[model samples]
Target: MIAIQDVKKLSSEEYLSQEKTNLIKHEYINGEVYEMPGASSAHVTIAGNMFFLLKSHLKGSNCRVYNADMKVRIDRLNVFYYPDVIVTCSEEDKGLNYYKKYPQIIIEVLSDSTESFDRGDKFADYRKIESLREYVLISQSKKRVDSFTKQDNNLWILESFSEEENLVIKSVNFNCAVSSLYEDLD
Candidate 1:
């Protein structure tokens, strides 16, 4: 994500208003908006696969799976991020038209450009959402996934999965082969 230089910071309302009509997507953080770059084919495929699998699994349940277009709002941090995939079962979130405040699971397809941010500051911000149970990072370059599950004490535990393992998302009670996420990419 790159900040639009020389542009003054915007209020949350102002950012949302512009985001709706803007052709490109921007992630809002601490009153500043950063331009989100286009995803690679692999990134798109992995996110699509995860969304499809989760959506299918949660069809009859109250949970809803959203792709990258949906935004997850961290009100406490005054930030909004477009996660690669999000699973929300909160009734309150269902009524909101623009963003979800209570996502149980958040998935981000990692790229060289955004990996560090996703792993560091972004993860820290996401952890502030009380309803978030798991934060997942999937590598588009390899069949690997890293999951950070929030413990009862509010601590996060990391579990890494390789190509041979099934990536288990306990928060959503869903699991899938790691290879399934990288369906059609070189």
Candidate 2:
């Protein structure tokens, strides 16, 4: 099990600069840090597939898609997370070194090693961002997609899609046949 520590005292700059190199990725929350494990082949495939589809669809538009290395900041919570895939339509986020805010769309390709946290505390932390419109969790082992969209009253609604049907992401005004998201994964 990963040990949890209190991190309410560290500055964002201090946290970013303190770590020079590491074998694994680490997520910084408040002042605490947790090591992230390497993803499996299936997980990578899903993420890559989503990136390709999103990238093509968002072309010539203000929105852009970023891969795993991009860091998204939740300033209100003083946290930084490396989302598997992030889509941003805000002009301020276009050339920023670090996203000092939440993304319009955040997607995590679920894997055995990180499914629980990805759906639990991580989602909780992400909700704190006011700019975030949708949170998506894509199953790496099965053809499933879970989407959480923020409602008019700032509440979130959960929507799930399987292989049998199509899914639409109202947040980004994007839609695709479900098969496109799970292609080449067998």
Task: Show how many residue pairs clash in every candidate, following the order shown.
Answer: 0, 1
Residue-by-residue lDDT tens digits, candidate 1, 31-113? 88889998988889889999999999899999999999999998898999999999999999989988899999999999999
- Candidate topping lDDT: 1
TM-score, cand. 1: 0.97
The list of candidate 2 runs beyond 4 A from truth reads: 1-10, 19-23
lDDT score of residue 34 within candidate 2: 68
What is the C-alpha lDDT profile of model 2 across 66-149, one tens digit per residue?
998777888878888889999988888876875536489999999888889899988999998888999999988778999999
**Model 2 TM-score on a 0 to 1 scale:** 0.89
lDDT of 2: 0.83
lDDT of each: 0.92, 0.83
**Per-residue lDDT value at 134 in model 1:** 95
